[model samples]
Target chain A: MGDAGKMNTTHRRLILLLLALLCALTSGCRRDQDAGKVRIKFWTFPLWTGITGNEKDGTTEDWPRLKIKEFEKTHPNIKIDLEVVTWQGGMQKLDLSALSGTYPDICYLATANLPKYASQGILEPIDADMTPEEVADIYPNVLDCCKYQGKTYVWPWLCNALVLAINVDLFKERHIEYLIPKPPERGWTYDQFTEACKALTFDRGDGHGKVYGYALYGIPLSVEYQMLTLVLGFGGQVYNKEGTQFTLNSPESIRGFQFLMDLLDKYKVVPPGPAGMQGGQVGQMFANQEVAIESSTSGVLKQLKMSAAKGDFPYFNAAIVQPPHLPGYKPASMLSVGGYAIFKQTDARKRRAAIEFARFLTNEENCRALTVIGQFPARKSVGNIYPGDVDMGVVSRLIPISRVYFTAGAAELNPVINNIYQSIFTHAMTPAEALADAEKKANKILAQDALEKGLDAKGGKQ
Target chain B: MTGQDSTLKRIIKSRWAYFFVAPAMIHFLVFSVYPILSTVYLSFVRFNLQGNTWVGAQNYQVALSDSIFWKSLANTALYTMVVVPVGVGIALFLSSLIFPLKPSRQNFFKGAFYLPQVVSAVVISMIWLWMFDSAHGLLNYLLSTLHLAPISWLGESRTALPSLMFMAVAGGGGSAIILYLAAMGGIPDSLYEAAQIDGANRWIEFWKITLPLLKPTTLYLVVMGTIGSFQVFTSIYMMTRGGPNFATNTIVYRIYQTAFEFLKLGRASAMALILALIIIGISAIQFKWLGTEVEY
Candidate 1:
């Protein structure tokens, strides 16, 4: 009897050791799994939330109110812990948690970043939890960005198509009344804009006018988004119609490149030399009554309105419109989105809970409320419910017509575009030369990817 | 039998020595050896969207083929070339000047110069970026007094790298100055007397004895300076963000772009490994060629 008792005690000790290791492996797994409740952790990028209503406790007030209200209505026993992270350093914090095997259940990051984390096996596939009908609910083209192969990674939260903001007061002062797109069809053609900007530019002899019609930021998104407007306006796309092949080297694309150059050299609408000054500087110029017409995101309009409400930028009476077209082309605007993703590390139970939470977050009412925090909702239903002084009627006009430029290999295309701009703007390469070089380099990269996948051999789509 | 028992006891006695050595050895192995070896190992792999996988020398091949990596390497070389000597030279000069000052004044000056050494590089870079602003900068305002046009210090690609070099030279006052000062203190005054008796002028004595004596310190400063300059991310990031174009992109920043931003960890590892080898090679050359000889 004594011998049997000792063996039993030893076995118990070994079992405890194994349990400790299992706990360590699933680092964030709660010990009290049978203890009557489920807990999920969620993170939000602070930048995703626009500075809302004047309250010191806005974050605490807003997050709890929504989370509690939704949870009480849906799953009263489920507990949610909300955390906020800034865009600038959010990834690093998450990276540490991931490395330690204690990552959050769900996180809202830029959808563009989905590929990187998904490849790391840190993010859970959304398809495993959600049905095909449910996946269809997200905005088209956006779901493509979040998926790697056939696996869904995140819910597409917001649609933020780039809308041009032109200062009407400055335009009127320069007698360039038609530059501001007050009416839908009556916007400036490319040549008209060029001539108008030339007329607006008055070199004040002593040092000349520092004012510019367009102040483009040096970053890739700023360059690409604006270039897409120019590219599509001139009948160009980054890829062929099916997007399986690269066609950025086509003659149509070259025309688009030439137009951007002509804006600086022939038209004088943009800043001189290789310098890149952003819309913030442009906005300040508008506030000081310097520039007439500029291209920027509509998000800036909200910021301007907030300042206008406080009477800070009193003269900043700017209006939003679709980006101006070339003399004869379809109007085009690119979209930028902040993404929300559920990780692969998330278990079945947690993944379901995350998907359920995502549905609650993107439901028209909550999505509209989310945008009050400063995000643009992806769904038209949410836009219809948007509560603000601005005309949602005008906002709805672009919903049907708007499109997100997408390709399976956006990751490869983005860097090449940045390289092309850097090379061309710095005078290291010319416009046609840069385009050709980018195409050649990009095709090789795509070919290598295809070869690695053995897609061509198998007759599979890239 | 008693002799055998005592021999076993002696072997047991040395067990305490293992206890003494194990902690430090384990710490070094875990922190230094493991990281370097893992980086070297990772550099050979390839990471696509699916995940990282072993792809023999593909990362290295790609890194070598990449123009950006080469450009960043060249930028690092230029930065090190400019900042290392200039920083060390200025530090040497300041140390020499302060060495002859009265004791209390010397201490005060030394402390003042060393204060910046304690503050972080990010703080220093931020302050300099504000001062170098093209529109509302103190540097431009100061230049305006000379009836000269204001310079766009960081805004222009041509001038951005040089302005960073200037910041490095100017702000290198503290730790370097103290190192040189300590070295100067240890130099025997008797040698100066012997040189003085030989009718050598101040410049000759300085060149002949003082300069030779300063070699070890100079070697140390140069190695440290070069290593610091090669890893010039914080300043570039805090200010120019690798360009007006890719002009300011350095090896360290490129690694950051690849590993952290782009998430090509394998390629980033290769780039970082190459940089480490270059730094080690340069330091070895400096030590081999110029490290001072010692007398017992």
Candidate 2:
């Protein structure tokens, strides 16, 4: 009786063990099946990823992460990995990744960099993937920024227009409050702007007054677009109508360049040592109330307001106004557009997932969410999220007339212009001489770029 | 036949050792050797994300003709010339001063100096950037307190490279100091006692004994420092971006710009090769000068 009972118990134990192993094997196979899901990698800058305000308030879920979660919920077979890259050295990192064949499936491309990536054929044409309604939703002007050879390569997201940020307290202290444009569309002419700068600069005759009228950023590469804002405001266009030539030495551009030099050299309204300062330093000077006015983009409004709220400024009532225009020229601002583009992907399913994810990130609802973080939505339907926000309202009014600082050879042309501007700041060349030199160098670069891309002399794509 | 069989048996017995080293050897081959060989090949070709084409010495010709390349090389040479000797001298002086301290005091000074080495170069550059700001920087603030007009420490071309040099000399000698102190510690106390008996003073003993005895350490530090300073990219990138009319541009920084920003990988590779040769040549010269045999 004991032997029979023992045998039966041993057999039952073996059977149970076999069943457990079978279950484990089946679960492992299921895990492998889940791993087969299509995964897309997205790289973006910190601007699109909003600040993580108090974790307890649940503001930590930034728009990109939130959209990814919703996307995964609907498309159960797809997964997305988001990588946030800093603006500093971001382009270098992307270039290395592209060369090494390790680039993400999707990446954020600045409007100025779009041509470089597009011309190199590193970006896939997204026009076929975008629906007509989706294409129609984006502002026409912004959509134009994403096109190269009539093919859309990017899904345009949000944009920021360069504007004049004024310290109201300084204006009041200087008794130049009337110089602030009322409607902003009828901005102050160049003469009035110069007068305001002179009045705002306080020397105090004892080396004690540290305030300056303007915070000029002459650091190369980063501040070129800000410099271009002043150039465009004076009726100067960077490239001609066909985008074939650089007009940096034109009469209008020379006037603009001379005026900037005068602000630093002749009038001394801008702070000295601007050649070493970057965009952040200018923003900091404005925030610290050390400068009366600064030329900045719409993105700085949130920071100025935050600084005011934090009591970091002595008197921090900031106002936005359209950039000054010349007497006979129309008012204009430098429009900078940043958005997402799909990298060249060989897998059809993965490419579709990447494009879908990019669309989801820039759709109307998501863009509206992005607006709360101080980005101007690219869709006309969204409009101004904060109509009451004076700074944003001014930005909205300026967007219609603002001109983008992009050309076929923008990436190559930027450094040359920056070098010329720096030379002027260093007193190495007069504005006319610098502009003339820049025109020569820019044309050389454009010619080389055209030759490299197998384009004709007229700058048409091969 | 018996000897060969025993060697084969020994190798088989020690197979685990080879197995353990395989990962590291494979890593060195893949990351180091492959990249070096690829860079050599890329130096003679035009490369892009899509593909590469043979350009055959065209990049080298461009680099030789490029004025910016020569300026960057000169900047690098100047940086190395200034940073190596000054940094090494300061490290030696500090190490001599700290050598006589008690163990606890020595550790305290060592830790204080070595702290900068532990910090990232990017962070150091950023802190110095604020400190060198023209209007609000601490340096300018100090100048103002002394009734001196503020000098644009990093704005003007005259002071931009020097400001970077000052930063390099300040905290960059941490590792060198530690190395010198360690080398000094290894010196026998009997030599100092012998010199004292010979009526030699501290300065004479330092010159006749300490300086000569520390030649090997000095040589090592000089070679390493020259190599490090020759590739000064981070500080330039973070602080100046080789700006003020390329006043602070260095070989490595220019190579970085050419490769990444301009997407001229071929030219960047050529520049990198030139830099490596310069570093090697300078190192060989340092070895020839300071590498005399010192008998303990």
Candidate 3:
């Protein structure tokens, strides 16, 4: 052969060798690295940040790292790979991971989303692993949300309930201190709440413009749990008992929506353009004392406590209250619970290790951290985490009356429900018309979900 | 030789050149082409992450019947209509203004305008969110100074979509300006001098020489701006989230909601295909209307 032919043969061989090496390097690298140890991938949001509303803290990783270190200390043969995801895009990441069949063995699942994942058969039921005593200890209502069909899908960890946070300073300034519900007496009629809002809202010549009385995030496409709290308090439910139909057009629901519109238009208490207001925006108004009362969650109570402890403000005085109810109904709160769910695993040893770590992560010792964040524990035995704190005490007492605002296909209905608020606030649709339109849109979503589930349009078996 | 044989021979003769382009071609095939093909396939199936069931044309039917889908399409069209023309106009105006300045001054203005392009869209959206705040926003503050009522820039349905368009027209002209400036610099000054010798005023000269010459750039900017506006998601996701009754919900945002939030990958894929077709149709029209052969 010529010299050129020889060099060409060598080049072909070299290229073939390089392609093989690249393939070997890219495939199954993780398994080769961890030869002896059982590796369990655990995905989580920054849940226990030692303070409420501290999920966004740059140091959120510290608490999770400490816990992972403690878990590894006890189980030397098992290694836990911790991945912390952000709240904004974490669920979508989880969905994409599941679709790719590369999801973590353990992850924190929002309770509202548990049914959807469980129905997809991606979640491993924790019922077989959980002890009967442990099962009994968890609050029944919170535990119910973690279950799909009849099996427990998630290990309930921590829960946050929607509550009313009032700026006591503003109430005092309006000379409506008597209207503020005391800690033990957390009840008020809708009429009384409106009267108080009227008294508190006024144009103060302080150059900061008019200080409003109340605000609840009315933006479309948000969770709308704060608004749902009012609906529940007025004896309305977004979904029927079986979660099979849209019942927002019920007379009671329209009344609830009308009350909010009255607050915005008639009473002139809520800030203008509620359709744009978000939770952060409303929270900012409450903090600035521009608004006297706002719908919030127990997380804010924890945030206030942290601010007070750190002396972040001179006087950070706030109280937790319940949403006012109609004359015959009871005050209600909307609750959102988050917990850990184990993904389906074929490796028995890795699955057991993940379960053990999940248990350790939510044990009584670690659950004490929930108190610092002004959150309620899933277990009743973790009783009275807040012994004497008035705000948290009120929150704890309201758990029984707390309602879950989600069902299967709740994500699809978010924009539909948000439209009702937007239309009502913008006066594009009256309360009745908006509620009816929302019901129509919501039914279409439910019908699509039903079709996917092989059921009839009304959500019954085909 | 046959065409295929000649092509193979040509590739073999220029083997080094082919090797140099291999990585980029492979990247384009794997990342872009593969996903697009997969999306087209998924659009014809019932994909639930667990399994895929073939159901041809069902997802497309559902998308066609969905009212929100039509509303979002209209919103996207409206956004593209306003943003593309105004954005290209602003870029051309700014480039014309900056072209005659000293090189140092021109560079300063170019860098200042291009700063937003370098910054993250999410960060820019957050800044705009605060600036549009009803109570404490700079816009409202300015209105209050003039003794006018503070407008709810994002909260009211009437103003929400317009607010987004304004944000795009204001900040989106940066990159287009750089493109325009480069295109403008490439145009020979001899054309302008000829027009001036023919007793053409500056305005007439600009109308006759500068505009016709910049047709290629203008066409590019319009088509690209339309595509970008149709896919407006980050700002909507960050600032308004298609709020105030979904007055600002665009096609891409709706697709995201359907795919990620609703977990209906198949339906999302169908909607995406519909969007792709619409873009293709509109771009074809733009090309046929505005396309021209410019001579140096």
Candidate 4:
């Protein structure tokens, strides 16, 4: 070949290589800017996966993955990247992402976290995104959990209500099944509940007890919901109706705190050193038939059923009963609600897509389908999805009256209240002293938060 | 002008060397330097999702007055004091005991002690948590077999910190033992033989010849162990979560909770900077005291 011909051939090859390199570098950017397609990131904890069935159990796909698939099928113009953040460190990860401006477009928010995020302006309001009919389908109590300062921030998805669970096999073995109200209509009053616990408790005067009547979960950091339910059942409220004051030191609240202390210290119907046990430990104790009664969320029902199916719980079967109330007070259950909240995004189309995806995930059919994984749907229209299941039915019925433990500055209030309960349970402080100390500290935190946010003493944003 | 030209020419001559190190330099600059500077800056400001506002030294002032911060600091100090000396002592003892053994026996002992070092702190904490369970734990079960009453290891405030210390002192000190063994191997046999010719006892030999020779290794382990113990978070996070009325709360755990849980980034940064200073001070003091010139 001629020298000019060889030079031209080399030049052509170099140009082609440069072009390929450019394309490789810009391919991701090009896909991101593709016309008519909106990409949204949805981050959620593993609340649904591996709960019920997988390849091993021969059930359908994971619910969150399935919901994403279905949503994409209908909304072909949108793509969602589902990131399952493990529940253990999920909150810290989300908080760091939020601070770094790399937060997902849509994220899950719990009742305790909703107000904190909303107050920080990290979440966008979704009031205008929902249709009236869609809004009406959700029960008011559940829907209120997603609201802060008269603005909706999340699409209510599923809720878990706290209830009293009993070891039915143990009760029968002890012939104390009669103590449990029959026909599911009559509920246990304070006196009846206390008497039954005393009868069921058997201590052989040794260091160990073969069976304790109740497993009181006293892990301070995570026991707020359970302990608050007891306080509510005793006709006391942690906060006033306006959520502006810390009323934990009220006479009724003190009485409730005293009642718990009496249960642990005076009566000794509960296991020793209950302060050391978390929810999972208490569940394990119940499964092992060491504790006859446990106050837990509805999710425990599914856990118990799974254990029974696996033959791990062969010694006893579990049943759910209404949480007992004080003599003159009505029964109450503390509700834990999980839902989706959209982050603040500058792109209009992406925000719309995120909201629509959230709505689709929480829609009636999808919410009902999620029940297979053991979460009660937030929408009231599809009630009692677990038909013929007596325990779940009772939990479903109580959903209407359940109250959330969300209060302003709950992120700061929780530790303080938890410390008070820990003190009471550990016998470090009297109930009155603990209640007073908690009220003082919590009020100080509330005032500081209010001052920082320019809110009034009455908790109104200025 | 000529000197500047030569300097530029020298840079151009070694450009490939600079190019080779550019990636590492950039990574260190972006990750390490930037975070350190950012944390220092954030310590004087109140940061939230919205933005940051200057709060001056208020965060430090608040931390100084806060009882919880002091309590956590005290807990961390106590943990470091207990874990460092005991861990180093145990490692020294074990390494000495295994030094004269046959190769196979030495390997067996070393591997048995070093096996736990490979396990993650989270997993070890979980195993300890199960062992410390109040009612049905293996520790309590063993206690019951001996006709001893069960102790609430992690439940009561008096025992919670001690339980964590026990876990640290038991499963930890593995790497230190290996390091000590390596250092002991480097010691000259002539010194030991000379001491033996003088009829020096084994205990005197260990105290005089062996212990003095391992000074550098002990100093290194002491500094590292002190730093590690001061930053103890994973065990507390997985096991106690600073519970039972802040008995097991350490400085790192409290800082994490303040930053992420309460969103008090400014306060958390201040606490972190204070902890860093304290660690540096402690390390400096340790070097001054135990860091002797061993030129054998």
Candidate 5:
């Protein structure tokens, strides 16, 4: 008892000493918030620059240099330490930095991953800055994904809507008549698509050269846009009327996966083993003249147009088509956005400086300039610039007819859907097999969130 | 003895030695001992971004059942099993190969083999990841030339573990090779000469003489290799991310992801404690296996 008493006294002293030390350290950092030049650290992944976009000498994308100059001019004293990260390790890097509570002033993340971060209180709500007019000025479909629980943490920027790029020269040589029936003015059926691709396909005989019907790059979610767009075209729904309940195992989503798989295994119209190539590889194949029709994001459109503007590359006849459709189908395509958010830093000046720099970078002018690279405007007045004078014939005709799948504040849904789609396409899991696996996994993620935070953690339908 | 004069002198002499050691001892306790003890304390608690609390046994419990923990453990076991003996074995073989060479040639070859060890593990792992990329990677390119179907070295689940192991062996080349050469250099040239004089061939001299002398160095390498391999983390984080379904997930990676990503601090701590225990246990086995029957 006497020894125990002595131990307790020693422990108490140790605890008090440690508390004093921590207080001294934390207060030292937090208190420095009051004074000092605002040092706003910005972290970002390179926006879709092909391997060549080195900002060092302006050989490729000069975005970093251009944006950095403008940002520094606006916030003269705020030292913006810009750190470039890679996509493969981006999320984990952000999470690790955030957990330290010493993250950069601003960082970019996919809009898909935002809700999870925001709900964790790692993201600062942008609700205060966004007036009703600002909300109206932004793409309603894009902005709808940024809000969570009537508050918003992120403002969407640099949107990438997928499109279909065709090798028009191949169509002309094959004597195949290709038509992009403009949406509302014209509608597309699945039969029309297959027939066009079939006519374009030519087998040059064994070991000589082979041209398959259509250059559909499969190899998994490389075809997600085509799948979702076709599903909406077929008037199929991914989720229920209320977004809370998942209906991935429903007939519509299953049919969507089935139709996608059929293009590869059944029709033999897609390239041999559409499941073997990734999205970018497929795009490169189209550029190299290995594929005829490429389903790719608009981010690549600028480059494709750039090459076209240069001269007979991928053949001069190449142009874009609006998202393809299925017969009796409504329009739907995957919606995605990549952008940055200023974290709530312990240093108030640094935080404000970072916020200011982020504002300078994402302003109307930068957004307009970014459009030349196929980054859609996040602001009201900046009109679309297609990197060319001519229109890619009849793009996203079903834009009005298509549905948006965003629970901006609720991120759990989209990734789960993506995971399902990837599994089916890559592992060759049947639509039923993939849907069953995804539904269970998706529900568990939601349940785990609900259990940890509270039932209301998933306020999707609510 | 002049006892009356001697007492203060003795005290002063002893105090001087302590004064000399005090700075280093203080540095050790502050930087080394304290952080380790703190981690142990953390393992008993629920650690998080802001603060942690003592939740004894809970973290341990979560680690006990985690599938990722077992996968990581299995990967470590496989790595330690492969790297320890093979690392020591090749070190021994290379030493024997160089032992009879001209002094100039011996040094050049030793330096060449040890070169890879001098390079950082992170840089080496990055190169390996590229070499292992499923498509458009160098490995695939080489395979294409051979008219073989491309093997997804890093991308495929089955090959990820083996790919990292190969890199580990290659990078692990440096330290063990040098240690074996030093051991070989010390084996009095007289012993080999004497054995050869007795009509023993080169192979006999190696197996009967050089190999036995290397026992101590071999033991040392075995213990160190086992300990190091059991704690592998950075490779998976850089390359496989324990994926294609938990193939390359090592214990350390699982612990880190668990604590940091999942935010299950208690669970993560538990996993770490288990890893620590496993490392200790494996070290014990290594000692038993490699322990020499020396007079000392």
Candidate 6:
């Protein structure tokens, strides 16, 4: 009845109006959809972004925009929405997306992650629509990486092979040319590699003048990827034939691991404090000519070339060679396959569109783009993509012997591998002790994972 | 019957005030409260992307039996034990030294200490990475000058956790100093003046007047600092990554790895609940012990 009462009534009405406006504004902001057009959300990491067209253009969608535009010309009814995620923590992002039922229609996945994603039933099978001829074109080794339970879940794209890259100038300076592996020869034996390392390692009187034979990142993940070469070359297997048990503690594997430790402790040819170093640091040391040899991969090569172009890198003449193997054992290299996977979609049309786009992306014509990033096309028909380039020529030759470093349950095994290296480098455990501990922990985790998946301890169906 | 109004009538009477606060309350419930409740629910289930199955206390049982979990808890406890008290003491000491200075001088010191607080934790950890580098780090360089054996600050199990603690003690006092300074400003200067007039020396006056009055500020710092130390992940994630054989691993880092990396969301939730309960228990103990003496 009074002035204050009138003010209160008016304020309440205003607040109600504002609240209604807020609700309407939020609700109206749903993602825009074009009439009669199927929108497919595509997510990818910066794979193949080293190509000229894939460079950033002030948007996250740039790397794959050209390809999308080409695809859109033929498929008028389907629209592509692309989001490029970073390699770091991308798997977690994918996991979260899958959990929320908001995953992209298509995304890039690695072989390491394929097992987990495929087992979750979040991925659509790629083989369902593939022609027999199309399937046969892909390299069997790389293509097999995409399969789970006889169904292909990923469209094979590229094979990432890691090899030993030695500083040619350092070898020349040490007069160890004969020790380097030349063509027509398989890699040197462990004794030969050790001899070369001793020869190349030298100390200068200046404070900054020590050049070690080799320097490697001792972090667990890096060890699993880079140092696994030693394990494999020494005739060690990460898992038993049944994929049931950890076998890195076997005598052969222990010998391999001991050789790595000996390189640091006995030979003292590697720089100190490898336990604290990261992969990038060792790469930098190689570029800076502080170390003689490094375990180099296609990704590292891409980085090195980019740095050189930017004039930010200390340039060096490098040669690719096979990692040293034990006598009577074949030399081996680690390969990580990169590929595109289509997520399970409710709409049949959207699923078809996704498969078509995936096929187009991996076609022979577009496969050449992989060369820019130092990746080998997954299709054997694509063949010798590097052509005349000497370094890649060596890598192409090595691809036949390359093996997938990670298999099912890699997420569980990798951390254990990392810890074993850490324990050894920190002197907390000897090589044999560390490997035994790793086997124990990894087996428990793998067994638990297998049980959760309704499988036997050997990763077999019950 | 004479005093109480009907619920609808009471709500109508204060309808305008309630409307003004509705947005904030809704935001809190959606972002904070809902997630917490979800986590608690999830702690009792085995979460799958397809569906979550109820498995009460199994995740907790797994965590309790795991040796790494216990090690991580002990590491977190050790980190909190060293960092929280040391962090509070540094803040108190710095605040006491700066409180008597001119406003401009106080602001200078405050800004200097607060610089790390403003800089991203990732950037600070990167800088410390260089400082802690065993072969080329500044600390090793300093030791080399004195003809002492170089220490692997983050590469060795014994030194990794302590190195992190030192970093925390050094860089963690900025916000606490600001809080302590504000608390010190609120204390009537007459208390210090009366103590001085009664022939109490500076040290005696500080021990009797300044320190005791700062109890409330210290209590807040200790509780918050303890919580912060227990949740340490960035420095470990960025610098050590719980490496050197898990010497630097903490509860939060393990939880993050479980939920995100390994996709054991249910186990992560259970570990999180356990952590929450532990923090709550510790906070309660802190309040009981320190809250008894507060006067302001």
lDDT digits (tens) for residues A193-281 of candidate 3? 99989998999897768888898566634577786777667777788867779987888888888888889888898888888877777
Please give, for residues A1-462, the per-residue lDDT of candidate 6 as tens digits: 899999999999999999999888776653333457788998998664434534554344554898898899898788998888887777768988987888999998887787777766789987768899988888777877788756799998888677888888888888888888876343778899889888888976678857888885655442357877876787888877556788878888888878888999999988777777776777777887788888877556666666787798666677777788777877878777878899988899999989999998888877888866778888889888876776777777777678755566666566678888788888889889998899888888778776666622223221
Off-target runs (Cα >4 Å) in candidate 6 are: A1-37, A48-63, A184-186, A220-223, A455-462, B1-5
Docking model 4 quality class: acceptable
Tell me how much of the true interface, by contacts, candidate 2 captures. 0.43
Top candidate by lDDT: 3
lDDT of 2 by residue, B69-104 (tens): 898999989988999899999999999999999999
DockQ of 3: 0.31
Sort by TM-score, best first.
6, 3, 4, 2, 1, 5
Model 2 reaches an interface RMSD of 4.9
TM-score of 3: 0.90
Give the range of the ten consecutive residues with the poorest summed lDDT in model 5 chain B.
Answer: B46-55
Q: How many clashes does each candidate structure show, in the order listed?
A: 5, 0, 0, 0, 15, 1
In terms of TM-score, which candidate is strongest?
Answer: 6
C-alpha lDDT score of every prediction, in listed order: 0.68, 0.81, 0.84, 0.82, 0.63, 0.82
lDDT of 5 by residue, A1-462 (tens): 699999999999999999999999899976575345566677887664533342334422356655776777765565566777877676778877776676777887667666556655667777666668777777766665566545666666666555566667777777764454443333456776667666656665664244555543332321144546654555556555445455667776677677767776676666543333345556666776656776666555567766666674644456655555655544456666656686766766766676666566667776766644655665545554443433322332322223456542244343346545445545546788878876775565555444434422333211
Decreasing DockQ order of the candidates: 2, 3, 4, 6, 1, 5
Best candidate, DockQ: 2
- CA displacement after TM-score superposition, residue B285 of candidate 6 (Å): 0.6
| Superposed Cα deviation of residue A286, candidate 4 (Å) | 1.2
Model 3 residue B129 lDDT score: 91
Model 4 per-residue lDDT tens digits across residues A63-159 = 5677788898899899888888877788879888988889999988886688767877889999898899888988888888888877899898898
lDDT score, candidate 5, position A100: 68
Query: What local lDDT does model 2 show for residue B288?
Result: 90
